[model samples]
Target chain A: MSISDSTILSVQDVSISYLAHRGKVRAVSRVSFDLHQGESLALIGESGCGKSTLNLGIIRLLPKTGRIDQGKILYTTRDGRVVDVLGLSEREMREFRWAECAMVFQAALNSLNPVIRVRDMVYDTAQAHGRHDRVQIRKRMLELFRRVRLDPERVFNAYPHELSGGMRQRVLLALGVLLNPQVVILDEPTTAVDILTQRTILEVLRELRAAMGFSIIFISHDLSIAAEMADTVATMYAGEIVEIGPVEELFYRPRHAYTLGLLEAVPKLSVGAQELVSIPGSPPDLIEPPPGCKFHPRCPFVTERCRREPPPLVEEAPGHRVACFESARVLAHSQPVR
Target chain B: MEATTSPQAVQSGWAAFWKATRRALTGYTARTLLQGLLTIWAVMTFTFVLIRQMPSNPVQIEAERIVREELVSYEEAYSRAASLFDFDPNQPIIEQYVEYLAKLIRLDFGQSITSAGTPVLDQILQYLPWTVFSVGLGLLISFTIGIFVGMAMAYWRGGILDNVVTALASILFGIPNYIIALLIILILGVQLKLFSVAEALGRVDPTIEPGFTPEYIGSVLSHAILPVVTYVSATVGGWILTMKSSTIATLGEEYVTVAQARGLSQWRVLTAYVGRNAMLPLVTRLAISIGFVVGGSVIIEDIYRYRGLGKFLTTAIVARDYTSMQGVFLVIAVSVVVANMLADVLYGALDPRVRVGKEQ
Candidate 1:
């Protein structure tokens, strides 16, 4: 990738494992992806599909029990330099986190300090990175609140609990952007709010990304929403990415069987009478995964070879890849998935 | 239409208060209350029975001792024991129980046979304040230190400071309170001559009778130092450990992680989010400690020879002062109940989720 092509972050073959009762469990298995400037990459998956693990692994925010078994996470800093985030010391990580890559976690309502005012929470980011003077920080905070469409004066003194769910998410988003990080990670940020509130948060995030030109790694289970918000969509299954492509290609012309199954699972409002389909089986266990292809047990077009060997992700089109041996056969046998 | 004024609004305000109060009392069960009362009664009764069942007969022992020491004749000692303790060896069990209940109802603890004619209640009242002061102060110091240090360690987890505090706290926890007290007295009191060894009663030197003056206060405090330090050092570890563990657990909560994601500093997150939530368990633990504070100071008092209730109880046990034993037991029982009640009320006040009256 060219240095000036606005590629903000690159995750190269990242694998994370956690200490569990039954030996080591691989939570994220050899995940690799990138976040370009001003673009959102939605890591779409079920709860245990390693989407959150991958996100956490990328930021080195995994819990103490979790370890980066293998990987290199490179972040393109503001001054046009690539820094390996995983290689940074704890102190260096603390310094780099908010200033270089801020994360807005899921359940933003509870993320705020119950005792502190909203403005203080926002100002904290600026202070940690030592980016601005007190006056400048205050001005930036007010500007952020305005950008997130909240009343600066009203929310400045209000505690987290005082604000509604949407407002809290906005405040969190404001905090994330306070330091003008090159990349922002939203880990299911809108999942906890109501439908209308989720829409508002999505719009605000879109606006922020547009205005600031920060790449976003938007983690969510809702495939439709991810399709709506993401430039690139990577569907994960059992700690592995089954498919990755442009938003339209992944949603409309899903190549992988698992991706097709996911797209089919979404309740389509446009299809007036069709019964909503769901993936037949549960995700494979992480501790002792299937010997062959992890999804072969669940894949409808599971062939002998598919059951005997794992398939590698092969790029069939430009920026379109699928990890399934029977992708062509499945596509020929059935109607277009979407 | 008047938009601001509504009958429903006034009703809702009153309803909200009532709801809060009811919720505050939630989870308290009749069974729990009965169980607590029964446990207290059992403990008090067991203590009373155990003391009475001791190998030595109080009347006989006192009579023989008085005769041997030439303090009183056999007749005088026997009469004194009978009149003072109402000791009737020939009386029926039922009759004795009736007398006990009657005396209990009248709040008459009888006279201390060992202390000539001193009232048991008066004896207890005399020493209760000293025990409360020493143990209460020690507990207060430990709690304050534990909370702040625990929070510091939790905030800077995995660092050298955290490891050092954890190591020191574990060491403190491993040693016994009495051992710590003995060591302190040996080092500070006997060797350094900074404070008096044992003999920690009265206002000051008997000749001066300083009585509550600054010099007297200073002497009293100096005397109390060994016991307080020992007690705090030994026991503070548990509080620190509990607070540290709870803080660590709280830090793992979704809310705290959210706080971090919201760009809260380590300190701000520790104080506002992690520490406050973690304090719930610590508060409950402190409340429990308060309930047992009197019972817990026995070793410390014994080590320092402090004129506290523990010392009085020990003397009563040795002298076979049945009346004083009963008096001490009753006071302890009442103290525990009152402390627990205070804890319950405080818990309701601190945690909005705790409902007081709604408890079963």
Candidate 2:
């Protein structure tokens, strides 16, 4: 299982379900993955593939309808104790959250308390954790603003409405990492900002990641963004990690047909007029999913056996896993020196 | 003329002054203020015209009443009505309107035809305070209670407490204010014999002279018990339901998720993020309510037989005192328009988004 001493957080066969109107929707089914210390893991996926559900599940911030069906979110705390996070009571959970692993939400612009000043909201969080020294908090806030590449003077006193979307996103980021937590879950942080602002935010995040040394669970639908931000990449399909490997290997030599399909979908400027190949057929209804392989219905090389039995996630190479019956044959056919 | 004079400094000074003036009196603010004034004028004009158009004139109504009650011949009655009711109905409508407008400009509301020939303005001043005090206090209490309780209901939505509050508030809202008044009078005043039913009928004990003394004040409050209860029961439901729905919608907002992700306590998130944001619509509602509340006081005053502007207006209507009717309606319209203006200003103050959006 590659159980290591330096593993900061790991999801061990974690499963989550949604009590939707239609009935139980298995959002995340037996997803197992380990995040090593100081290594960013991007849970890349198409929408409704349960990337966000799994991301929220780690921090126990699942919506009222969602629940952890089974397995544990094992978080290795500062004193070397591997604590089952869900076991903590609401009080302990509150303490463990933000202090251990904070979240940078997708709705960055609206996330801030619109009525409260950015300075006060940031100050109060610092105060709640016993950073009572007002001077120190102010200093830290200015430092954070600078780190996030926001002007402290204008933004600190101004309300959320006064700031632009990019500025608000930066403020949210500053607030998230203000406590200097071990992990920050950024769920599509740059989706709302312009391209220029997105680039600037990414640069700031990279700088912060280097300086703070916190691992990131960077969740995004954009494969290119995930490729840029993460070291290890996990591609999810229909609420399961269909393929996972290092970024370079996953991008260049994907074993799963879904992953290959996604790569071909991204419009390549270098490839000239090679039309982007889009995958067809929608995701199965979670309430009444087809038996056998969930991807078989949509697979390019669907075989009888693939339709008969679900392909288990198997490690084809060291630290590289693929869940497909026809991956070996397809890999052989598609093998080319890049 | 100093043609070679430095135009830049002179023009810059003038430009800066103009800029400052424009900021102080922004186009939006000016527009809103003018709109308020226009609304008040329109309402006053409408009330004046409508009151004048009523089927029964003061002289005809008075002459009929005199003929019915006293030993007066039709000739004597007509002569008395013509002398007593000095307002000439035979005058052209335009001339009367012009005269009314001039009186309106000078804040003169003409004379009451029913009461000891008091001026309409004087009668309004006498009764307006009572209605304001009772209705205003009730609204404030209900607003505070409804806001907090409603927010709590939203926070604990789909639970037993939420259902209970929702049901109770719904009942209060559905019933008419007078019916609620009757119910309170039945239950508290008559059934339980908690408060004296007789004392609940008036603004205060007739025996006690009207003064600011403790005794008189106590009498007024006791008398107010039933009417205020009626007022609260009638209005609190709308506030609770509105605030509850607002808060629930806000709770679903992504900002709330962000607030939680920031590790704020449930209380902090609910109150600061959810409650504060939700309360904005209510603030404007409350302000507009404050203005329209004088109108709301009409039925409640009639129910209690309290000597408020509402009761006085009712009496004036029954007596066909068109002057008093026009006067009271004018007051109501003015108050409502002014209240709306206050609400808009308050909105701009509380929400910078509103202010900044307009400026840009």
Interface Cα RMSD per model, in Å? 3.5, 1.5
After TM-score superposition, what is the CA distance of residue B140 in candidate 2 from its true location, in Å? Answer: 1.9
**Tens-digit lDDT track of model 1 for B1-360:** 466667778889999999987765554555456656777667767776778788776677767776788878789987766665556655665675566657877888878767767888888888988788888889999999999888778867989988998999999999988888777778876899875564553323445456768877787786677677777998899888888888888887876765555444677667767788889867877887887778787767766678788989988887788778888888788778767766776776666456356434
**Residue A101 in candidate 2, Cα distance off native in Å:** 1.4
Best by lDDT: 2
**In candidate 1, how many clashes are counted?**
18
TM-score of chain A considered alone, across all candidate predictions: 0.96, 0.96
Tens digits of lDDT, candidate 2, B267-287? 877778888899999999999
Q: For every candidate structure, what is the RMSD over all alpha carbons to the true structure, in angstroms?
A: 7.9, 3.3
Clashes of each: 18, 0
lDDT of 1 by residue, A1-338 (tens): 33345778888888899999898888888887777878789898888988888877766778878999887888887778888888887777777776777888888766765555676666665666665587888888888889889998788777676688889889888878888888888889888889988888888888887888888888988877897899999989888888889998777777788888777777778767788888888998899998778998888988899878889988987898888888887566446534
Query: lDDT for each of the candidates?
Result: 0.79, 0.85
What RMSD does model 2 have? 3.3
Candidate 1 deviant stretches above 4 angstroms: A1-4, A113-120, A131-155, A162-167, A333-338, B1-133, B140-241, B259-276, B287-295, B298-304, B313-360
Which ranges in model 2 have alpha carbons more than 4 Å from their true place?
A1-3, B1-26, B164-168, B182-196, B212-214, B356-360
